[model samples]
Target: MEIRWLEAFVAVAEELHFGRAAARLRLAQSPLSQTIRKLEKELGTTLFDRSTRSVALTPAGHAFLPHAHRVFEELELGRQATRATAGVVYGTVSIGFSGALNHLTLPPLTRAVRQRYPEVQLSLTGRVMTGDGVEQLEQGGLDIAFVGLPIDPSPVRTRLIGREPLGAALPIDHPLARESAIDLADLADEGFITTPAAAGSALQELATQACVKAGFRPRVVQEITDPYMILTLVSAGVGVALMSSGVAGIMPSSATFVPLRGEPTYMDHALAWLDDNPSPVLKAVLALAEEVLPTPER
Candidate 1:
């Protein structure tokens, strides 16, 4: 029998009266009764016992009630899942990023995405949001990412999200920290802690550019992977490092932050996604990113 027949049967069984069942199902009594009879004939069992004055369930009706409710529940659940996928309200997206994401716009962006699309889980990978991360996004391994600019930009589309002022991380007692704004020339003689060559090039590029702008090449004393480690090295007076102001939150106690001069060599933060043909979910994420960032003129 058709699902309509099963539905009519369920309503009639629940209400135990032809008129009330029809009212609940938004149908007329005669049609509802006929539909129930058809279902009973197909199943070869009567679903209800009716008299001129009373109505009751047959043993078969009791057994079929739960099954009918379950079928409808499962069907509705399947429909809801489909709608959520279409709207990107529910799905898992793989994301890749560097260890120092908390140093830029990424923190609030991820937080906003989580708060709004609670069902769209992000499966994060990679310590640096760079080459491999961009490649994975093109390969369908990642959906969207927060990364440094000046990437190869071969297969991925990127939007410049925001720019934050770069800061100098120096020992609290370091003489350069006394400057109103730390000039790159001031750090020229100071040893610098840098990021790994293979992981993230953003930090390395920032240091190099800042020093060149200041008329000297920075002295790289050591390269470390973790931001906190870089801070610890500075705290121990190994050298100073340059990065966005957001890095201030995770700095070691011995290190103090000082502003960078002449635009601070602000790191460009971009959101990267597949360029050839982005998915609906990716489109939604890009739109969300745009909303979070302000317009160019503003």
Candidate 2:
């Protein structure tokens, strides 16, 4: 039966008097009695025993009362849930970050999101290579990504969040590590450990360009994907590699990070997302990024 029919049935069942039930429902007596009669006919059972002066529930009316009350209860709960969800930002937002950049970026951004938009769930994917992050964003898998640059402009939009000085990761016992800052030329004769150029590591280009500018081509002995592994290889004296100064925060003790001397070199970290991304939560996140992330220093 219809919900209004059930409402009428419940009101009449409770009041046990047609006039009183109509008054409680804010309906006129004739319409209220007609609604109850229609409900009983739809259910194929008599719901009330009525006389000129009194009205009382039949056995079937007693049996249906509790179930009818439960239906209304469920409808109320559904309304409450809808209202609550409408007032808050509630959805899952997948965020991707390259492993190398997480130490410098993810924690602060995550903290700010948790504080400001707790209703928005964060699905974090770590070790997402810069290129992979962009691809994920374009494919609708990632809502936002913190990635490295040398990123060619595409359908995805990017905003520079931070720029860090490029530094050399050297073995603790390496002669260059003794200096406060080491020039790129100081490592001219050193074999280098680096991520593959095809892996879309922005530092790979920076390293190659800086070395060429320093008048030497690096002899890359090991090509790795993970920055931590690159550090491990350098610690074992595999070779020197260029990395952001922030790497020092998570670098293993076996390696030392020394700022590169001479003309300054920088690596950019940016927030990238599909230009057409339609998530309202993504918009909220970008606004928060503006507030929480440091402005990129040229």
Candidate 3:
């Protein structure tokens, strides 16, 4: 039977009133009735029990209803996929972003996409670290990602989009907090609060390793992943933290941010996607990012 016949059948089964179903489908009642009749004849079964006053689904119709719904759903999904592949102005692009990059990058990127590709949908997944973002991009869960660098750029193509220097976050009352700048070596005696290595905190790893290179190992008192929470721990006087400079703007009032002295240390942010990914929406998003953010010199 034709798909339209199935549509008519399902609509009628739901509404249980021919006039209402016909009105809902924007079809004349007589033609809708004819389509249902044709569908029932093709199946060699009576689908609906009709009276002068009302209509109800027969046992056969009840069993067929679910299958009809599935057919329509699958067909519609296929249509949308085909349209998206054809570069139609539709479909969704899922983006994964690290927490540190969220405040600086996500809002403007989302607004640009919505403005340029109004019909395309944007799905944002935040707080994903570089390692998880890389995994998600490979598994097709994310179309693109803004990740902290020191990532293995192999297999997935990545481009540097932004950079922020690593800085010290200290309790406001700490003696060292009075310094406009603090060297990593000077903080050796203090406990450190940082993200876990397994959480793929490239910046934290870099900071800790730098401390090690400076003739002292960090005594980490807290291992947390969320950027703001790390700052909160610092503010509570738990330990000093090495965090991105951007945190200075939103860090807790009890915490003070100081530039790291003696080296131009920085955390690089990059946009990454599977090299084999052939999404046109991804292409459009990259173009927008190029225009909005300053790309690192190759």
Q: What is the C-alpha lDDT of each candidate?
A: 0.75, 0.83, 0.83
Question: Could you tell me the lDDT of residue 170 within candidate 1?
Answer: 92
What lDDT is obtained when candidate 1 is compared to the true structure? 0.75
Considering summed lDDT, which 10 consecutive residues are worst modelled in model 2? Answer: 76-85
Where model 2 places Cα greater than 4 Å from the true spot, the runs are 1-85
Q: List the candidates ranked by TM-score, beginning with the highest.
A: 3, 2, 1
lDDT of 3 by residue, 1-298 (tens): 7889988998899999999999999999999999988998999999999999999999999999989997875675566568777766555788987675367877788888888888778888877788888888887789898888778655777888878888899999999898988778898899998887787767777787778877898998898877778889999999998877877888789999988887667788888888676665677778888887768664
Q: 1-298, model 2: which lDDT tens digit per residue?
A: 7999998998888889888889999999999988988998899999999999888889998999889987975675465456456776555678988676568788888899999989778999876778878888887679898877768777888888888888899999998787888778888899999877776777788888889999999999999877788988988888888888889877778789999888877888888888666566677788898998967668
TM-score of each: 0.65, 0.69, 0.70
For residue 1, model 3's alpha carbon misses the true position, in angstroms, by: 15
